[model samples]
Target: MGILEKIGDIEREIARTQKNKATEHHLGLLKAKLAKFRAELLEPKSAGGAKGEGFDVMKSGDARVVMIGFPSVGKSTLLNKVTKTQSEAGAYEFTTLTCIPGKIDYNGAEIQLLDLPGIIEGAAQGKGRGRQVIAVARTADLILMMLDATKSRKQRTLLEAELEAVGLRINTRKPNIYFKIKKGGGISYNKTCNLTHLNERLVAQILQSYKIFNAEILIREDCTVDQFIDVVLGNRKYVKCLYCYNKVDEISLEEVDRLAHEPNTVVVSCEQNLNLDYLIEQIWYHLNLLRVYTKKRGEFPDFSDGLIMRNGATVEHVCHSIHRSLVENFKYALVWGTSTKHDPQRVGLAHTVDTEDVVQIVSK
Candidate 1:
């Protein structure tokens, strides 16, 4: 039987099975099996086939964001409106067949925005270049999950599921589980805290399903079976996503207010230019970027433009971002901002810097 058919059968079985303390281990094994089969199906075919157009786009900017949704959901329009890029927008579906790139300059940071081809149901099964589209999204710093205000909410669910199937965990943090494989220690399990959803036996069964016989596992937080499997697989992308409900001008104020209250949701009308600035602000906030100004010896700090870094960035990270050689040739950094103890406090490469911090690198 084909891999998809087998996967379908297993999914049905899982659905039919009852969940209980006695059956938890069995269910965990089934989930692990399903994940393994899906991974196998996603692997490239060994048999040579005709080469098709590739969707790989060179990433250019401080950060990259991609627009993803069903066709005719105003992804292209929003891209054009915000970034001034001329991606064709139409009333018909599938108007965008390729990746269209644009740049959004906000607060001295350049963010790359990509308008990807619309995704449909069965995308995870390689239907209609859906895999290619998702592959591009895997590299993004953030995903803009656009939805038409008039469309059914089922579209959003389908899009999220398809992305999840491809190992994209949206708006999720990495599981607080430390997993290591040993040559022959016989699977040791440790938990720093109580596990509300998983037990040791079920975790062992799931690990065995992946052929992991000897490993050390540590769980620091409450997590689910799927999360454990994700850690074991080790190819999942944990990314932040913004749920953008476009064409809000066509909807009622009550509807806009309702959507605005939803977590990580932004309601905007690209055609009417409504709430675009707020949307941009939310993007900047969620990206958690840090802007650091650089200064040379006995020179004023450059404020016109600053080096963009992710939150929790350190002086060592700054040096690496500037040039690899800087890390080796570096001595110390002088910081003049909230991260410093006194005015222009001298700090080492390990010193973490905050936004608007002025840094001067003194190297021999």
Candidate 2:
């Protein structure tokens, strides 16, 4: 009768049920219920327990990336090797009892790298400080899933499951499903393209399970029931995860090569100080950051200190980042970069900025 029990039962049912067109609706409803129960399980108790200690580190830098894996997987070692901050690196399990923060400055951007405590199997169920670790993981811009190259591949699978159970969709994009809850109209289901996984009936059943009687549903792409569940919950973190396999020195070259070839995977040996630079480069790439240099009217642009901005940032964003009051002055920006057809082209607040662009804001 508990939320966990309900979630387990639904999961078992979903696993045992044969996948067919006949059972699609049943499966959809079951997944919706499972998501509901999981959400409830994660809700705070009425007793209002004190939060875990050392997990409240203030977020700094342009982006945050958290190291997550089982203990003794070289998370701390990697953190210590990459960043100036020294996290305790040990050969024993649970060496890191709390969240440890470090900083990495690469390509004019400051990245906050956190070495989180090891995550256990039942992390979603709040086992072994799993809840606290996962709570911090959700806040990260990227997840550095550190694994042991010497260990079996099961570690990666289990870690993925634990994070997946908690609504962390790694290296994945959000489902292209347009869903809106209407006040009075009945379900208006439409699809732009052919959807093989979901139909109007199954969609209606899934929506009704969440007590959504009136809604507008537009299926833009072919997505599964679980993805639809994620859309309905609307709290899932679709983050980019880089699978970092440490201790590659202990593994065979063939094994190391295989891991390195895997998508979004990096193989490194923190103890041997190998491939750490490339790992940092990959982190910068996946973070999707941009550096824009600012110029005064007469003086040259300070290329030494470029303004770090996110990808797809605009002139307005640049103004706000420089100073909140800059936008209030109503100015135009002179952009000199690949983004402009001519050198130092004048643009408005809506103009998107590119990496290494020289921006000079002219106020009215």
Candidate 1 residue lDDT tens string, 170-197: 9989999999989997889999988877
Q: Which 10 consecutive residues of model 1 have the lowest summed lDDT? A: 43-52
In candidate 2, how many Å is residue 28 off? 1.4
**Cα-based RMSD of the predictions, in order?**
1.6, 1.5
How many residue pairs clash per model? 0, 0
Off by over 4 Å in 1: 45-47
- Native-to-model Cα distance after best TM-score fit, residue 119 in candidate 2, in Å: 0.6
TM-score of 2: 0.96
Q: After superposition, how far is residue 292 of candidate 1 from its true place, in Å?
A: 0.9
Q: Least accurate stretch of 10 residues (summed lDDT) in model 2? A: 45-54
lDDT of each: 0.91, 0.90
Q: What tens digits encode model 2's per-residue C-alpha lDDT throughout 216-322? A: 88888999989988998899999999999989999888988888999999999999999999999999989999999999999999999999998999999999889
